[model samples]
Target: MKIARLSSADIHWCEDGDPQGVPVVFANSLGTDLRLWDKVIELMPKQGLRLIRFDKRGHGLSSCPPGPYSMEDLVEDTRELLKVAGVHSCIFVGLSIGGMIGQLLASRQPSLVQGLVLSNTGAKMGEAAMWQERISSIRAGGIDALADAILERWFSGKFRQSDECLAWRHMLTRTPVEGYIGCCEAIAGTDLTASTSKLDLSVIGIGGADDLASPPELVRNTAALVAGSRYVEIAAAGHLPCVEQPHQFAGHLMTFFKEDLHVTKV
Candidate 1:
């Protein structure tokens, strides 16, 4: 684990496997840290892949920037974080807001991205009013009220009653409200219509079959906008399916990145 400083924020990251191996940079969804990828990493093929996971600005141990961030800010921070981490370029695998940032990163700086795994995210995110309401609620009170709503929507009803669901409540409680709102604003303001149409990289879009946030239809639509993009859905899981169904999620990812799409000569 390492904390790399960017001009605007601190990036908390973890690296595993050989330095010379295929670099895979993992980014988490809004309001969460790199730990979101823990189960996913455990299932990743170790033969040829080096895994990297990081927390975005204002989240986890990373520095908290002020309220609201732009996609460009997130993209710049990511580029600098990778540079400071001694990474030149990598195959990016992103979830939710991280996925949105990846789209911008690949579109704006093609050289820095090789292949892409965009999971549980949409090209253009939510409506402005919806995010504003969320931010307003957090500002009025805190994440407590919102956390329950998020959890209910993120995990299926069955999972909510299980032991696994209890463990994640802490993750929700410990989150920085400032960081959550910042990402909400970013999602509210940004539009990825251009990037989805423009990004010319090997891409795979994955979603949870039962996801409330980014549903299967949403994932399919997002992928269809991109030229010849592959799409897959993990069953019996919701928003954070990577955690709930790690084995199945990783299986889909491995097939997409390794077996399905041929990587360009690196």
Candidate 2:
């Protein structure tokens, strides 16, 4: 297992494809680990790319620090992880809270990110009060309490009936309470509207037609913040389109790499 021992936390990370190939770093959504990108990675071209993925501070095998983490903390952890992994510049693909991290990181350290893909996320995820309420509920009853509702938002009704949905439910309910709450607090405190609007890099915003967490309009609006960003919505999918519709999602990513970033091999 690959690990980056950052000052604040030990981040679990993994890389695929050539080390010298063009870099593409992926950041996971809340309550998920690096494996969140497994299906998408499998569909990607086998050559000429270095795909990096990591578990955020408190999720997956990473150590849980404490509750109420900040967005700055998450961004710094990712920054350090990239440095340790020897990535100088790369396209960043972020989902949900991961997308928020990509926005802040690109804003603060523009030289580090060359392109961005924001998937099923918003500049401001939700109101602080709503996050606080969810946090309280989790604290009182653990992550299992909200697993059903969260899964509903994550996948469409047809997917919810499939056996694969049970595995996602397990991933959700198994997330550490403190870790989940910490991310919730971080999401609650972040608002990337102004920062994201100032970004000049190439960007693509992807949304799921069935997404209830961050609707298609919200994702499109966030993408519109960038001067020349593009937006696409996937049908029959929800918040985690990479999981629900990997083939279509991967196609969009490959197109962005080739057309916008001018990546020929990937």
Candidate 3:
């Protein structure tokens, strides 16, 4: 269990693959931890990449600070984690809220991110009112009250019937309430359309065809913000394609690394 003590929190992280290989950093969605990428990582080529996965301040094993954190706070946590891990540059793969963090981070510090794989996310998520309503629901009844609804948005109907879906339910409901709500507040206040449109970095957006949240059109539109970005939609998957369709997801990542970023084994 590796941990980086940043100014505001203790981030839990893990490293894999060749130390000298090209760097790839993964940021997970809200209500999830570093384990969110476990299946995707297993499918990735192990020879030529340095894989870094970390829990955000309010999620996973990382310490949860006070409520109502900002997007800037999340980005700073990622920046400090990378600095502590000795990663000067990397291809960042982010899902859901993680993708928002990726967008803002790339805009603010382009040199640190060589490329981005934005999965099931957008520059602007739902409206503040909607998020606030969801926040109120969670606060009133706890995550369990909304777990079924959230899971429906997260997975395809077929996947939801499987036992694997139960595990995700557990993961979601187990998330600290304050942490989840804090991220909700961050998402509520963030609108990165202008900043994302100005990014000159290489980017590819992936979305689940069955996704209810951050639908394919939304992901495609966000990708279009960058002049030369690309977009792909995975069939039979929902919000978390990395979980529901990891092989397809990893294939996209490998393609982007070799073709777009020109990343090759060192």
| Residues 1-266, model 3: lDDT tens digits | 99999999999999888788888999999999999999988887778899999999878899999978999999999999999999999899999999999999999899999999889999999999999999999999999999999999999999999999999999999999999999999999999999999999999999999999899999999999999999999999999999999899989999889899988673
Model 1 residue 228 lDDT score:
70
Q: Candidate 3: minimum summed lDDT over ten consecutive residues — where?
A: 257-266
Query: Clash pairs of candidate 2?
Result: none
Clashes of each: 0, 0, 0
lDDT of each: 0.84, 0.94, 0.94
lDDT of 1 by residue, 79-106 (tens): 9988887777788998989899998999
Query: Per-prediction TM-score, please?
Result: 0.95, 0.99, 0.99
Question: Which model, 1 or 3, shows the larger TM-score?
Answer: 3
| Model 2: per-residue Cα lDDT over 88-182, one tens digit each | 89899999999999999999999999999999999999999999999999989999988999998999999999999999888888888899999
Please give the lDDT score for candidate 2: 0.94
**What TM-score does candidate 2 reach?**
0.99
